[model samples]
Target: MEPGVPDDSENLSDSDIRLETVIQQARLAAGIDGQNYRRRFGSTLETDFGSALLRCEEEGLLEAIPGGAGWRPTSRGFRLNNRIGLLLLEHRSSGPDMDRSNAHGMAES
Candidate 1:
């Protein structure tokens, strides 16, 4: 495995990767589609970010940062974020202990 890279990365759902990226980006700035993310990951990643953001928003897990074109986790989002982080860690460390299905049915880099 590539150090720090999830061992079962190939098996990770696009939603998982997208949400992770958004969370990481939010830490750096406070948004889902920051310039750096767009530059490094390309526009294709934006679609994933959009869908992920919408899903979280719908789930009451994320909300816009007042007047900014950014998002922040709601209290509910924060609680679920920890659960997600742990699930991801479990997948990474255990290496395919559970089956993960991609609803999109298409693999994205």
Candidate 2:
């Protein structure tokens, strides 16, 4: 894999996937309320998933409104999530073990 890239076998849990889905949905919907997202995802908004979304915002993947408000995905965030989806798909296709070395061409460089 690329030096820092996570292996496909390192799959996100259902909760994580749900969080990502919520983020994407929020993006599609323009913005999303934290409470509403929490409800939809069947988890508290203060858990690791919520924290991850905040981290995404800090990393420029999304933008959070002020006053503890809602969030919107940035162009970069949208693109990243798309890429993540593809990677996940590839991982699934490769089976649970997921040959990351081949998938990432780590042997080439």
Candidate 3:
């Protein structure tokens, strides 16, 4: 939980990961159209998911084509997802019972 790095649990939920996977699959398989995206995500195109889409676009993770129905993931998004998976794997291997009080105290100096 570095200052700028969001706590993994806070930034991504199970649903968010599932949605990301679905979006990635759609992009790879047949590409996601607005209708398909909405149906798959169980939400509208103008909600929080919509905001996420926009954020992803801004982050260069995805793109929204003018007059197109759905968005597409950029190369960066694909790479980012892979990196995130690796980080999660590392965190899992380290386990969650790690005590950080000593580390925090040292940092205070």
Candidate 4:
């Protein structure tokens, strides 16, 4: 519910369905390429990304679309993502300023 975070919009429309398809393709490619990369470079990751996603699904954080296009985040997943966003925002705000640029003449004033 934060300014930039999307809420529990789980009901998938036509556009959402298309997005799901794209997500599925991207995940598939990442899984394949990621496994190959691990084997070639000896990644320390024990479980694969795909398996992690499957575990998430099993935990009710996501559910596969009816036509198998891809998965959509459940309400719990939405809450988790929102909380993560909030944490990231808080962390950034609490950290030392990374941008060295002092624009708008405020640093001089």
For TM-score, the strongest prediction is 2
Question: Candidate 2, after superposition: displacement of residue 81 in Å?
Answer: 2.7
**Per-residue lDDT for 7-61 in model 4, tens only?**
7667865433432433343333222232333344343112212333344556665
- Candidate 2 per-residue lDDT over residues 1-109, each given as its tens digit: 6988767666788756754665456546375565565566654333423444445556676666554445666788676766434443443344443222221121211
Rate residue 15 of model 4 by lDDT: 35
Q: Which pairs clash in model 2? A: none
lDDT of 1 by residue, 1-109 (tens): 6888886635667445654675565433344544445465553332444444545666776666542335666777666775434433443444322221122331224
Residue 96 deviation, candidate 4, in Å? 36
- Local accuracy by lDDT, each model: 0.49, 0.51, 0.48, 0.38
**Candidate 4 segments whose C-alpha is farther than 4 A from its true place:** 1-48, 82-109
Error of 1 at 14 (Å): 11
Per-structure clash totals for the candidates: 0, 0, 0, 0
Q: Report the CA-based lDDT of candidate 4 relative to the real structure.
A: 0.38
- Sort by lDDT, best first: what order? 2, 1, 3, 4
Instruction: After superposing candidate 3 on the true structure, give the runs of residues whose Cα lies further than 4 Å from its correct spot.
Output: 1-21, 24-30, 39-43, 82-109
Q: Which ten residues in a row have the lowest lDDT in candidate 3?
A: 100-109
lDDT of 3 at 70: 57
Estimate the lDDT of model 2.
Answer: 0.51
